[model samples]
Target: MSKLLKFSAETGEKFLTYSLVSVGLGTVIAQVAPHVWFLDNYAGLFQLYKKGFAVEVPSHFETMLSEISDDLAIPVKNPLTRLLTVIGFDTMHFGTTSTTSGCFIGIPVNFNYKSEKDIDKLSIQVGNKSVPWDSKDGIELANSLILSDAAKRFGIAYELSLVDTFKFYLHCFSGPVIVIICGGVNNYFCNIFGLPYRPFPVKGVFYGLLIAFGIGFYYLSKDLITTYYEMQALKNVSKVGEEYITGGLEFYDKLLARNKALRNLLPDGSSEFNTDGDSIYLFRKKHVPITVKKQLLEKELEKLNHSNII
Candidate 1:
């Protein structure tokens, strides 16, 4: 009822919706009328932010990013480390000695050539430790996060909308075709303000307001859309993080189990590391990096605990 209708964090308030409507209306007018400057501005804006976000980085990124990177093994030399170097994350390489890696769009991720051996060669450094990856999950998680970040940075899903390509088809190509054929026929019948009835400098005041509004829309949209997606992405990452942790623990279990079987059967003094010592694999790479979603992991673990307790 009122709660649903109320302007709140959940809804990005009414202003965002209103701004979207206004912006959408303005864009439509720019297309139909195809007023040169208006259309040009719309097209330019779309081209600029076509990838669902503007090019700016977020401010509070370090805090949340730290939460993500905490104990998340990165290569001693990794692109991710390079990307976050300004914020005190300075590492090198996302791959092994023969492995090649690079960053794209500011995301510290390795290039995926779709080769298993190449990917498996990738390892990240956590403190003095090296954690290796075998699966594509880390890269996948990075892609979602990168896109979400772009959206958050730019303030719209224009990057997600893939609308710039559509604009090329609908406006850049078709708009001209329609304008040309219509112009030719109109010349014979009517003279609409000599040629090309420009709207700017006439309705510039109104058009200027819409452009101004669009700027605000960009900011708010980033705030709203990013707020929502960040939550969901974090939830997914948390689940993956849990799996990554569990796998590591299980890998340790395997080593312990094997050693236990060997130790008990070996009678008096027939062991390599030590007769009574706990077998700890120091050099062996156990699990890949785990990127956690802070709050989501708590909630997830809570649910599991509740079920077990019941």
Candidate 2:
């Protein structure tokens, strides 16, 4: 095999160079390709057109998206923001979009049910004990999962606002940016200290540290971008109207309650989620907590109420 192609401690520089390029290309493909190839081309594969849900849910979402499309400057009719009902996903949110066409949104199939009986099939079953939909807590849980029409539109609007900005492209490019910066730094230091010719142990430790640093940098950037853009989306959603402002408050409240219910119902609830219903993150959190989200909307409502009283 060629010297660069051979896998050995002697060819550390070649390995490092290949690793950096591989990671950079991998990140770009993972982030951008799914939207372009899968979502835009064959979104119908993931779309749920169940007997009862086919007409109502998608039609409502399309109408809601169109109503706010002008205000948000997102196109409604052409290159449509497609809708799909995802089974495993328990909430509604924005999915990835194609750079060439438009974006898509995912709604949890469970979110389509309005009453307790309607969602019984999806109830949590731990061993033999099933979470009943008729009990007082069960009724509350059911109610929490189903949002008012106004709250539903607000949720859709929030997801729409998320894609309305240039943040997705920025997020996609972050992976390559980190790869370039880390690779450049490593190469600079290697040249200064004489790298590939250095002892095996020294080179190993140096490469390992650089890899760790790159991973840490990736996660930190990901968290910061998520936090900032989510807050910005909420701010944009608040501009729609008074009903949507009220809807935002209700949406978060219902989300928190649903998580609280899940915590009580599921077998591993306590470990999986906190008291406030946010996931118990091992390292960094990727989204705003439900409690904090609700509080922000509540503050907006308070301001609206005070202004009206005057």
Candidate 3:
């Protein structure tokens, strides 16, 4: 019975010693572990998160637009077409010509007159000639064609802005959290071994848990941060959309006002002017000499090219 008691006491002491040693070692390792390779791989996690956010969010936004367009039976091939359709145009024709200087010039004109009578009565002319085109179908087609194209283009720009915001959030939030977790894990691991020696299976298990805890903490923090920023970005986008719509209305109002003012400058009963505020005035006047402007431009370019101050 005495021998048994001595054996039990010895066993107890050894267990306590082992436990203390293991814990001490674990604490040290946890502090240094983040500098190791496993933590380094966490960078890839951040990269993945960033890339995933970028790919998914924009795709989702586009998908929503596409579905809406499809449901409305709107053509989605060219955003402009979809915009035109939304604005109420049945048919649209758009064409562009390019200059030798690589500039593209586009001429877009919408016609609402469906019948010869409407065309003649409207007195609308294009390029010094009255349009042989007319429609009794009302001006909805022309208005729709113009508005739809504008709207689609605006939508594209909005989508791009959303994408940029998403990317910014991913980089700012996910990236830093991943880096922090990786760094912490490495620091913990390096502290684990005070001396160079092989790690036992049990020690390895504890180390793995420590790393996991660090990584888990980082992920949770990252998720929270990302969500917060995403919400903010979404709110901003909503505001941006509202602003765009309001601005568009204002722009059209100003444009129409300017057109009206110009029309008032024209002579009454002139076929060169239309009630819809379009003008088609042409005069066979001699071209103003371009020599002075050309000379001035040439001198400026020469000065710029030869400037020693850089």
> What TM-score, over all chains together, does every model reach?
0.25, 0.85, 0.25
Scored by CA lDDT, what does every candidate get?
0.33, 0.72, 0.36
The sequence of per-residue lDDT tens digits that candidate 1 reaches over residues 41-90 is: 33333222214554333445444334333433222234232122111111
TM-score of 3: 0.25
Worst 10 contiguous positions by lDDT, candidate 3: 96-105
lDDT of 3 by residue, 41-127 (tens): 322232212223421222333454455344333334442311111111112111101111111111112222223343232433433
Q: What's model 1's overall lDDT?
A: 0.33
In candidate 2, position 117 carries an lDDT of 62
Q: What are the clash counts of all predictions, listed in order?
A: 13, 0, 37
Misplaced by over 4 Å in model 1 are 1-84, 88-202, 241-297
Deviation from native of the Cα of residue 201 in model 1, angstroms = 8.1
lDDT sort, best first: 2, 3, 1
Which is the winner by TM-score between candidate 2 and candidate 3? Answer: 2
Off by over 4 Å in 3: 1-159, 166-169, 172-180, 192-198, 214-218, 241-310
Query: Tens digits of per-residue lDDT for model 2 on 94-188?
Result: 43433556777766665566665666455455334776767665666778877777887777778878866666777788899999999888879
